[model samples]
Target: MKKQALSLLLALSLMSVPALAKENSADNFVRGKTYAGQFSDLPEGHTFYENVAALYEYGLSVGQADGTYGLTAPMTVGQAVIFAGRIRSLYRTGDPEAGPAAFTAAAIGLKDAQRVYAPYLWYLQAEGVLDKALDEQLANVATRAQMAHVLANLLPETVLPPVNDSLITQAYASRRRITDVTEYTPYYNDILKLYRCGISVGSDETGSFLPDSPITRGAAAAMLTRMVDPSLRLTPDWHLPELYSAEGAAYEDLVTAGTYIAAPETAADYDQAVRYMLSQGENTLSLKYDQDFTVSSAQEALNNALLAVKRHCEQGYNNASCSYNAAGTMILKFSSIAGDRTEEYRSETLSAAIAVHDALWQQGTITPASTQREIAWAYYQWIAANCTYDDAGDNTSVSHLPYSLFHNGKAVCDGYTGAYNLLLKLEGIDCYALPNATHIWTVATLDGETVHIDATWGDQGNTGTKQYFAMTPEQSYSLHPWPKENELPQ
Candidate 1:
């Protein structure tokens, strides 16, 4: 399937050759050592990795000789502008290699449009990635900050928003390695957080997040090494030659611990990293069961399970351009890709999962359940009051979990339902984990008919900690709509 997609993309690229004004390269992206890797001229130190690979496979970025990327080459303002424009094009019409046809034609100001590289001005303007810049000095030149803003616009709101103001303006600007605000806001934020943790460093100028200059590949890799495992500074094994540090016990430890398949330092290292992070070690939590264990033990075991689950969730998020917080709200490109799956991301999965064993012990005592509807009445109240009466005309599919939307807790739809199910399971009630077309919801059985219970709606409502659609099994979900052949696993 992967190979087939690549073939299709390559074919598309060929078909697009006539329409595209610029010559395409196969090897432009270089994976950074850190989340934000600056470009470098050197081979090992400067090749673009995953994103580049995807670009090449899709004909966005190609490769160079020696199987390396000239990532270090300075990016021009116009080039960066065009690159960003291409990303916007890919985002809107669903194909960077394809032409614009399915997109809604939005009006753009001619003055700001004139500043963009002519080749991509249309796409950028169409996607709203382009800022009018009409009243600002930047109206003439595109900066890294502007480019980052465009990416931010392309990405899910769950993804980090653009960074503004120099860190020097913040208390940490002096030692902060943050620079250039325009290109990679999330990476910048992650880098900002790390530097605040004393994991990264800074330039000689005023303490600030450059937010404009691109990062170096080597610097990026090193930062990734630090972010994933701070103990890497101490360990000795995971360290690679020349890459590993000695004398620096802290840095050396980073070499001793595990690596990431998700974060492949080298093609050869991908296997080991994946194994260590996914298949083995503490990164993957274990569930221990004792038939005779006390309720406290059970709680501890559950907490452990949750920790592992959180790690998995975080990793899954890392792989995706979208993500969910603990509340299960999702932030992603809802309208374009799969409209908001926030409905599914938050629903009753967790409730059902926990209910699997909540009755096994029947301790005859209460426990704190993490469901969105049970003890967390505050949670329910938040969602109910916050949800907008989703406009029929607004088809932009951006999604936010109930928790996030109301309480800044965000869960996707699945997360919302799963949380409701989880809480109800704790309270000893059977709720409906309903999956609708492109969405999953929950129906708590109400009095006689099943009432539609949406935890996300709960978050948007004004009620306190209670189900937004709570009732008897019949009222919440028993309406008998005659299940479709593919309606959830009901």
Candidate 2:
């Protein structure tokens, strides 16, 4: 049968092309390397590797002089026609080169003599594979969508007819890469045909068919292999690595350790630093600041550190006081008892703050029924009922600490604001100490509004009334004025 097919070519006055491959003893066909160095550029494990190899083995295609298969380079109309005709010839007579002679003979009679694809174009016209009206596109690149339509028309009924649209649609939808094609996609039926015949699989596992994407020569070679033998399969598994910023790992480590560094170089580092401080436990944060850091970054980090300290107290860290510098050098005590002469006195102070917070939580002061404003008011009343105004106060007096208000039931304005902020913070209502030169007060978020609450003033004869409860910034200014009202949260 092969002899008769070869004889038919001679009868057409066709000249024989010399065999390209040479018999060699160099062991040139290495498994990981190219076949006889023909496609040296084709890397192993590529999506089209096996299929292109099969096409080369079947004598349907050859690589360029530089040994590149050009898998991603666009396939011209000439190349597409040659591939289609070669597959047809291979199927009919088991001779892959059988169609080239007929194509060459037909090219000489064409008016467009300068056309490189004229022979393949005329051959396709004679076989009724394509019409002469498409001559203008002879030099244009073949598209994936166009390939789908052409494959549907040329392949056998058994290969082309049984493409289950429903199965293809289900498969297409399951893949993550394909975004353009839907059940309602244009050229929908032809796409189903290509999928059914195994001539095309959407780009990788991502489900991107890229239907309109221009087809490449090496890709065409693989597609041709599938068309000739529908049993051949090409499934691509491509994974792109996840990208991360330079600070991502460091930030993650800080969060995992539950340790805060007050000076971090970047914004990401600053956030992780805050999160580390917030996470519950015995937090021994380094109070040292980097002298070579930006002021805005340093301030933001310091502010967060302070908030973390308050959150620490809110989370029941009464006995443990986190100490840090107030300015660049002057150290100040935050949250814990102040002016304790000995360890025995300091231990007693911690016990008092915990006892007060536990008593409120047990009383359901922060229950679902109570609003943040209502709970805050209750805290103000608690402070008044328990604590007395400490008039004869020194700057380092224990009366200035939250510990004094809870432990001794005697406090200055600092102690009133500190104790009030601590209790309100414990309930998760945002509260902070607002300070002036001589006095301190509390600013809290209540009923979704930032307001001022002066528990000291509310302590009229230690009565603890609603007269000073939940006052707006403007309202509080009338009785007690502060210069930096615009600096607070709106």
- Say which candidate scores most in TM-score: 2
TM-score, each model? 0.26, 0.38
Q: Which ten residues in a row are the worst by lDDT in model 2?
A: 242-251
lDDT of 1 by residue, 113-175 (tens): 333344454555555645554224322443334433433343322222222222222323212
Model 1, C-alpha of 137: deviation from truth (Å): 9.7
> Model 2: per-residue lDDT, tens digit, 198-257?
566677555567777888866777777676554664433323111101111211121223
Error of 2 at 28 (Å): 27
Candidate 1 clashes: the total is: 126
Off by over 4 Å in 2: 1-34, 109-116, 131-133, 159-166, 169-179, 182-187, 204-206, 234-490
Global fold similarity of model 2 (TM-score): 0.38
